[model samples]
Target: MEQKQFFTEKPRILIVDDELGPRESLRMILKPYYEVYTAKDGISALEAIKKNPIDLVTLDLRMPGMPGEEVLKHIKNFDPTIEVIIITGYGTLQSAVEAIKYKVFDYILKPFNVSDILSVVKKCIGRRYVSGEIKNVLEKTKRDTKSHSEIYEQITHFLNQLNESCYYFFRRENYLEFVRVLATTLESKDPYTVGHSERVCHYSSLIAEGLGLSPDEKEKLQISAYLHDIGKIGISDIYISKDGPLDENEWAIVREHPIKGIKIISPLGLSSEVIEGIKYHHERFDGKGYPEGLSGKNIPLFARIIAIADAYDALTIGRPYKSPLSKNEALLEIKKCAGSQFDEELVEVFIEEIKKNDREINQMH
Candidate 1:
């Protein structure tokens, strides 16, 4: 089946500058025509892009930490169709020129004329692609007084005529991998639960298949399971390291993880299933769960699947306060709570899947 096609409503433009004044000013100027984002420095600028699709960036030539040119290089390497325009001071014209080689769409002088900025942006809106001819023009650009050469102007006009707007997926593959690494890092906080999230992912996939979930549902389930516990990354080491049972206060903090998970994963532009799975996985079948008491079918299907796998992993892997349950013991406990803690039908499917000890369950077997 064809993957679902994703679309963005408006062009997203990021204004990257260390100076708050200029960054805010650019955001204000572009706010009407586009969805504008600001970054105080280069690192945050790249992070912002990772969080969402950035159709264009009006970049300040100078910034501390990561250089503007380096950020441009990363952006081009990530997705060349993302148009970049240099916003440079008179003294930094040389740096601006350097960025052109990396496929900067255009440049404007600092203390920019609103008309000039708007003119270039208006022309660039549907003009995200860069042709070889345009790059050759940038390469051959001789310091000219007419803002840009005649050839560059001709190429720009030609591009505008082509109307090449870029479309991007809400989440990039590399960023999703980065999020996996983050989950791994959180698990690292306790040596016992190391690889816990990954195990849950594997088990969840098997459960999803046993339930005859569609490929799309399975795919989303995999992503949600991997990222489900990301909120634990925010928990203090003190709490995560406590060797004894958690007090009521500590338990409250622990229970807040679902809410925290939702917040951290909100900007990722995930599907509603994936987001809801992360938010409501802890909810129970008997209307007795924290965060929300969503019961039975009220809880999202994906969340229920994740909850089964999550509980299985947690029980078999043990925790700070308890020893790991043996395979048979964990299965018994899961069976005991089939209707209260987990979806009844899902529980039966999961138990059969676990008993089958197929390749997916090799770890437990």
Candidate 2:
């Protein structure tokens, strides 16, 4: 598997213009702050992008051979993440309007103000690092797909590329939202457990906040809680939403979900604690859990927190074999298991939080 290496450094800006004076001035304008690259025409501009990671590109609409519109299409087809700011000449309003379809970041009319240019650049270069790795994957996928003229092959290749990028890109940068999406995807597979993971995350966060967890710890817990059930997505589709009780074999498959979830999230650069939570949220406090049952304080702290939340949500929500418990009923169930399935101290925190704001909790029948 080819790994995507995304940006982790100063932003790289590319300037594309046919005219000498404007291109030079644009380069000089952004030179002090950005690592700048310049190309006199669209052909050269495209090539320059291929050679290096680029955060933003400023392109002139009036290039000779490869017109700005065509170049912009190729750029979009190549790497859509590259922020493109169009430089339009007089009477080119029509061309600029058409370019918007390609999703150019914004258009900068000719005789541009320096401050306006600076502001646009600042806004477009949203990330500190360029998406170099995804760009490489996108470029390679396009090249491979283009080589085959069959529409079927092209569509298949495009879909595969989309999945690859979604998995890799969502794992980094904006990971919290990514975890939410992953949980939703899992819910779609298991009709019996809709919204289970998110409720777990919400409950766990409440407990974490009560414990005075630092912002970073809360983030880890949030991600862990959301993805704790992700491993179940790996189960055979037949077993996900089956109506009755599972046989021993089917139950075994269900139990392997934590490990499966860990594999799916392994590449997203999660902290060890978050990984631990996903892997051990089902563990028992009495040292009686599967998949390496380290008991008592030996279990990861975040995992312990997720376990309480996981159990609470399960008790409160009606599953295929169980009736939903009321808030107090669910609380009693959790309290009954505190010294066995959950961390006693964390349970105390969760109980306190619920008492303080019991009205906010769902009273699902």
Candidate 3:
């Protein structure tokens, strides 16, 4: 999709600056013609982009962390078409020239008039809006001229392309934001779950490597590990945050999260392998899990791999209800449950890898 495709409503621009004064002033001026949001720094700018939609970015050249050039590269990597305007100081002609080479839309000097910025934004909006409208018209024409059945097929193709573009365009931020929300929400209810997802992803990928799984299988396992508990998002805080053991009824609700998460992302057209991993990560090797009671080998390989990582992280991480087990203790606990709760061989391999890279692993997490 073109840069213009992102601007459908009012032009959305994210102004990033460390100085509160300039950031707010830019917002005040751009608010009239476009929807404007301000970021105190690049980190916040990236965070905001993940949570919201942005068409154009007006970026300050200097910031404590993540200077303008770096931010521009990130925005481009996230979505190549995202238009960015660099904010340069009057004497920073060299930086302005460098930004131009980096595909910045334009550079605006500091102490500039609001009307000057306004005019530049107005031109950007017109370019984006008109181009998007033209693309829409062309697609409509294609649909009208095609046979009815073909037209429907074409529509599906276009929609899928659009979804994929949007998916990648926002995937980096949205995915991270989703994790943050899940982690924070879980943390609010129970502090022990803090950083649970990230830890699981790291361990699961390592285990996948230890098992020498195929590249595709490793990636699937990694994604499933990261999102395994996404369904937990829908579970009520009353059930999730409880310091005491869940009652039978609460346990039943907790068991349904795999299916819930599967349902949530199914429409995204992810690989069936990834879906299966998410759905069965909680199932046991001995057929004693919730949602499904699939036995050893019947449980998907990716799911079995994740079970080890997920359980290990849970045991190692401090939870509201229980104290964190030491690494040795956690390993012993995992070994005890190997036949029933985890794939025994995978667990062994995971432990071996951990022992071999113990120091490196500590540094990583």
Candidate 4:
């Protein structure tokens, strides 16, 4: 059977096993479709991973000298993006659970069916290709000082290249994971703002729970909250990490993030609700926000929930221009701005939720 190559370069696969028969069997199965490499044990596997741009590894858990679990940790520490599959004759419930904890793409017992192996390998390679394409889009967007229109065109072209695979890549878990990676990448640009998106997502979920939002609504809101600040990716690091007040010009660039975020993500065919949340998260309830001064209920519901959550995080973490506030002090400020900066009802719900989970919330921060 012939496998269609979706990438210009063949995706690389490394087979690591202590036994010759099982190792060579995997090599034979994968070689025709991928650039395959072989490592007889964990030590050699780590060396091969360093020497080659290996996209995937099929690891045997009981390898001698260095355990496969240890190698998996090193691989993730080196580059968490690389995909892995565990194939072991001695596979046990404990080993499978442990493999999942390390985020292996799949755990398969020995004597795996040929078709099943092929299916999993195909999906893994496809995922890797899609991730690479997205990274390229983001890198080009950041590196090239292109006009907004140009960036949109580039993203749209990349989407077109995905063709039918768009459905597969946007599957629930895959989509959320990719968005988290993008959010993490954006936060990496600023030292003070690390984990900002994840914290905001957590706060937003708490508010959603308080509001009794449907599971579907909660899912969309989670995506929106994580991506609310994605537009900041386009803004220069000088403004993002600045330790002092921004001059009017710097402030202007900072304010453009919402619009930039909308343009960057709108082409990816996301739901309007998700896009609106990103575009309007900074908008205030009293009609004093940027990009659009949408007031009260005029703001999208997801955006309103995210607005309160985003503010709470920023206040607690403290931006470069502001000193950090204690959780109680931040809650007090949020309470004071109820109708002015955030939706009034949502503010009450958020505050109540925070108080209920004070201990857990404190630990999260």
**Candidate No. with top lDDT:** 4
**Which runs in model 2 stand beyond 4 Å of their true positions?**
1-173, 359-365
Cα lDDT tens digits, model 1, 154-224, are: 33343343222211211232233334544564465468768988899888987987888897777788889
Clashing pairs in 4: none
- Specify the poorest-scoring 10-residue window by lDDT in model 3: 176-185
Candidate 4 lDDT score at position 210: 94
Whose TM-score is greatest here?
4
Please provide, for model 3 over 238-258, each residue's C-alpha lDDT reduced to its tens digit, 9 standing for 90 to 100: 777788899999999888888
Model 2, span 1-365: residue lDDT tens: 12213234557889999999999999898887778999999899999999998878998898899998888888878887787989987689778877876768778888978998976676555322223322343356456654312322332343345454554544443467556655654364356678888888899999988999998889889999988987664565466566678899987888887887787666565789999999988789998886678799999998899999888887888777678899899998899988998889889999989786665544531
Q: CA lDDT of each candidate?
A: 0.74, 0.75, 0.72, 0.81
- Which runs of model 3 end up more than 4 angstroms from their true locations? 7-165, 168-190, 361-365
Q: What TM-score would you give candidate 3 relative to the actual structure?
A: 0.56
Query: Alpha-carbon error at 364 in model 1, in Å?
Result: 15
After superposing candidate 1, which stretches have Cα over 4 Å from the reference? 1-178, 359-365
My TM-score estimates for the predictions, one after another, are 0.52, 0.55, 0.56, 0.74
Cα miss at 109, model 2 (Å)?
A: 28
Sorting all predicted structures by lDDT, with the top scorer first, yields 4, 2, 1, 3
Instruction: State model 2's lDDT.
Output: 0.75
Work out how many backbone clashes candidate 3 has: 0
